[model samples]
Target: MRAMAYRGPYKVRVEDRDMPCIEHPNDAIVKVSLAAICGSDLHLYHGMMPDTRVGHTFGHEFVGSVHEVGPSVQNLKPGDRVMVPFNVYCGSCYFCARGLYSNCHNVNANATAVGGIYGYSHTCGGYDGGQGEYVRVPFADVGPALIPEWMHEEDAVLLTDAVATGYFGAQLADIAEGDTVVVFGAGPIGLFAAQSSWLMGAGRVIVVDHLEYRLEKARTLAHAEVYNFAEYDDIVVELKKATDYLGADVAIDAVGAEADGNLLQHVTSAKFKLQGGSPVALNWAIDAVRKGGTISIMGAYGPMFSAVKFGDALNKGLTLRMNQCPVKRQWPRLFEHVRNGYLTPREIVTHRVPLEHIAEGYHLFSSKLDGCIKTLVLPHAG
Candidate 1:
């Protein structure tokens, strides 16, 4: 098998590796059909995530066919095409029974926070991801669903994480009818969050980012107002002004660890590793929302201390909601949205790279080169 191996910070390569075998009675071995290099994967690539061991593959968004299944995996058989949600969890666990699959208590050793995630760092769970020819899926009956005959493969793959997480982010915002929603970041998640806000009855949607390309995507794809924070003297003040000095009704933080507006914050968190993640975007979300409004955090952050504005949030009486998204929980509504033509998830895909060129794909996405919005990995591409 060929898998993407992490060499070090900002380094990765596809190399031959031993094929994964079913290790649990409920496990299944999936032959990778399609995989994606996600924004979360970049945290590992940039060394922002702790315990991202060398030789560990980094990928969580993927769709594939069942190559083999253990005796206990009764729902699927060989050659069954499926889209595996990024979460790895036991369906009957305390959290899982409540539909909080991302926080399942039975999986990961460090299950105090997030549950098992494929190909994420050891903090989430040290399971190998699907950025390879094949991957072993635990609790196979609970996580992987057969791809719908009417759905596009690209859409199925994106639904594994980015699409699901984005919709979940908007759901967490608790948007009300005719409310104005502000989204921080124009990445795939932010774009989806902005789009989902409209479906949830938001009257206005605003997306903020430093890149013009992504902002343009916000305008066209999400149909939201776009702002380049780099062009503003104070984006928070501008946001207030745009909202008639009251501030937006809701704000979502989709930029997590590597937010770049504040040099000091970026350097301290992303460069020096002093803080868990740069809170510039999150703090901006805090300041940009109305006093009694809600803020949703969809960004991925390290599990360390961050310079958050907890005091201000307390004073303003803002409702802060955040969690690693329960991916499968969002699928039913998302599938309907996709089927109803409200969302075209594959439209956001800007690049597709073969498995052999995964390192280059990582470089392209990490560097934000060539107007790259989303990059899919073709593990079996010829």
Candidate 2:
């Protein structure tokens, strides 16, 4: 099988690798039919996960047909198509019992929280990703992934990560019928946040991003008001005006470490705040939100042992809720949203390419120089 392997910083290559086989009695081997590069993938692309092995396959957001299943996997069969959750979990764990599968307490024991995940590293359980032709899924019978037949592979792929992230953002925000939501970053996660907020009954959803194309997608495709955070001299003032000075009840920062300006300046400038891949977005979201509001941070972050605005949080009385979207929690509901047509989140896919062109796909998505919002990788395409 040909899998994209991490070589080092800003490097990846499609390399021949062994096809994964089920190792656990409850495992299932899925033939990846549709997989998309996630904003989170950028971490490895940029070598943020320093702990990730040199040649490990790197992807987690994918949907495919079950190629094979172990004898204990009774609920799923060889022919069943499924969406794999980014978080690998043991359903019987303490955190899993409490509905926090990401912190399953059975995997990534060294992690401070429930931290086992695919395509991550020793800090995250070192599970191989699904970016290749096949992937091994442990505890598939109990993990958040569900085999839904009513959905297309392309559309259902997001149930694993992007859609769940969006749903989790709304869930963390406690979106309600009358609450207003402001989502930062019009990237894939941001777009999904806007859509999820609307579905959860937000009176108005306003998404912020500098990209013209992304803002357009938010307006016409997602049907939400947008703010060009670039043009606004006083973003707080403009957002206040849009929300009648109360500001949004919930503010979600979907842009991770990429929130800084030029890499050179931001790297050399004041190094305060969370020192992860995308903490600037968090700062902006905090200041943009109202005095008392909820902020959900779902953007994928690497390791950063640092402080991030505890004073502002203390002063503003902000309720900060964050996670990797905990793909395990939102998978079921996200699948329902897609199957029932409540969230057409796959609209973010601007380009689709075969597995042979994985390099080009990475280029298109990594730089995002074009209007490429989401790039889907086709492993079995001709």
Candidate 3:
């Protein structure tokens, strides 16, 4: 098997590796048919995530066919086409029973925070991801579902992470009817969040980003107002002005560690690694949202401390909600939305690269070149 190998920061290559076999009674070996290079994967590529070991493949959003299943895997058989959620968890645990699949206690040894995530760093349970030709899926019966016959494979693959997480971000916002929602970041997740806000009855949706292409996507795909944070002297103040000086009713931060606005924050967190992640987006959320409003955080951040505006959030009585998305939990409604033509997740996909050219794929996405929005990695293609 050929897998994406991480040699160091800003370095990765396709290398031949041993194929994964079922290691647990409940495990399944999935022959990856479609996989995506998520924005979150860039954290590992840039050495932002802790314990991202060399030779560990980095990918989480993937859909594939079951190559083999272990003795206890009864729900799926060989050749079953399935979409696996990013979460690796046991369904019967307390958290899982409560629909907090991302925090399942029975999967990761370090489940004090997030549960096991495919292809994330060791802090996320050290499981190999599906960027390779094959991947080992633990608790296969619980985490994967059969891809709907009506769904495109591209949509199914994005559902494994970006699409699901974006919808979850909107859900976490608790947007009321007629609420004005502002989303920070115009990445796939942010675009989805902005689009989902409209479905949730938001009167207006605003997407903030520094990129012109992504903002253009927000205007066209999401049908939301767009703001380039780089153009504004103070984006927070501008957001307040847009909301008639009261601030937006809800704000979602979809930019995590690599947010670039404050020079010092980005320098310290992203460059020097002094903090867990830059809290610029979150702080902007706190400042841009109205008092007593809700703020949803869907961005991936390190476990370390960040210089966030906790005091302002408390003072303004803001509801702060954040967690690693429980991907499977958002699927039912999402499936309905996709079926009704309300969402076209594949529309966000800008590039598709063969398995052999995945290093170039990573470079394209990481560098934000070629108007890249979302990139899909084809593990089995020429």
Q: Write the per-residue lDDT of candidate 2 for residues 250-359, one digit (tens) a residue.
A: 89888776533335323443333322134556766777777888888887665653335668977999999877656766766776777778777667789988887887
Candidate 1's C-alpha runs over 4 A off are 259-277
| TM-scores for all predictions | 0.96, 0.91, 0.96
Worst 10 residues of 2 by lDDT: 268-277
Better of 1 and 2 by TM-score: 1
Ranking by lDDT: 1, 3, 2
**Which has the better lDDT: candidate 2, or candidate 3?**
3
Better of 1 and 3 by lDDT: 1
Please write out the lDDT profile of model 3 over residues 246-292, one tens digit for every residue: 99999998988763333356544332321223587788899899989
Instruction: List model 1 lDDT by residue over 261-380, tens digit each.
Output: 233565443323212235878888888999999999999987656678899999999999999888888888899999999999999999999999999999999888999999999999
Score candidate 3 by TM-score against the native: 0.96
* Collision pairs in model 3: none
Alpha-carbon RMSD to native, per candidate: 2.5, 2.9, 2.6
Note the Cα lDDT for every prediction shown.
Answer: 0.89, 0.77, 0.89
